[model samples]
Target: MTRRVPFAWFARNILVGTLLGGAYGAIHDQVSWSISPEYFTKFKFEQFAWAEIGLEPRLAASWIGFLATWWAGAIAAYAVCRMAFRHAFQDGASSWPLGRVVRRLLAVLMVAMAGGGCGFAYARMRAQDVERLWGGWRTYAGVQDLEAFATVGSIHNFGYAGALLGIVLVAVHIKVKGRVDRSSPQSLPPPGR
Candidate 1:
């Protein structure tokens, strides 16, 4: 039998995931900028307006990219969590023992990591293609530079970290709920007559 989670709980998870994702996106973009300002500048110039190249435009593009990935990561994490919970419920594991919860959260983290790795690979390939098409307009320091920036700047890192944080938050929530449930009048001894 499947147990339904309260709507409030579900909504809270989604909101938390969204905020974490946005934070990750913003930080990752900044780090990427710091590591290779030229690459980002070139990428933004190519993607946006080639003639209008400036720091402000690059920063604006970064912001847009961050917001886009943030929403995407948040939605993805929320969906995965909802599915995980539903599967657990179907398997009659709604009680959420610490071990079970950890395992589930780990599974989510792995998914995020794998997704990030695949995304990095795809982006790298696309960047290379763009470079080739444009007759190598931008000069890359080396392959390692691209790899480093892609891995570090990717939203996957944020997703993984966010998932870990989400797990901890959920665990704490469960513990607090357990305590409240246990201390409720239903569990407490009846009043002395």
Candidate 2:
């Protein structure tokens, strides 16, 4: 039987994952803000009540980003630790380690970012439709440039969807790696770990 995630360190892994996800979200939201500040000014600021607190729009948006996605990282870490570390041991050898787990989850972050970028591009290309069809379109009627606001919203939407998909993909990848390593007799733990 293979070793599961080392219980002692999994909490640390979850913390790192949560922080990383927050950073990604904050950065992504900054980009979205750059593209359409109204997305934050008219929508997110109010939704998060930062506008009421009189915080700077950009700062508020960044906080919103972090709050929105930090949990995603924790979930991702748990899934990765469970799936990938089960393959950690085989034939009295340990293969996957916590460091490797972090790296793999970072790959998941990249995949999610890629999806966000694509969503931004697609929404930009169809800005008019996005603005018209966005669920909050009427709520944001006062927005100076409704299309830009909606495009940014679409970017956020696509990013969340992408993160979910990215996790699934990463899970499949690690599972395949587990299967491959299971067949080999060479999977071994690091010398000092």
Query: C-alpha displacement of 78 in model 2, angstroms?
Result: 1.0
Candidate 1 per-residue C-alpha lDDT over 1-193 given as tens digits, one digit per residue, 9 for 90 to 100: 4566656655655655565556545565665566555445555445545334355844654664456455644564455455546533433333443354434444544555555556566556666554444333335433335544454444445545555555545445545555665566775657893
lDDT of 1: 0.52
RMSD of 2: 4.3
Candidate with maximal lDDT: 2
Stretches of candidate 1 exceeding 4 Å from the true structure: 1-5, 42-62, 90-193
Per-residue lDDT tens digits of candidate 2, residues 113-164?
A: 8788788788878865764576466564577777777777777888888888
Off by over 4 Å in 2: 1-5, 50-54, 90-95, 135-141, 188-193
Model 2: pairs clashing at backbone N, Cα or C within 3 Å: none
Span of 10 residues, lowest total lDDT, candidate 2: 87-96
RMSD of each: 9.8, 4.3
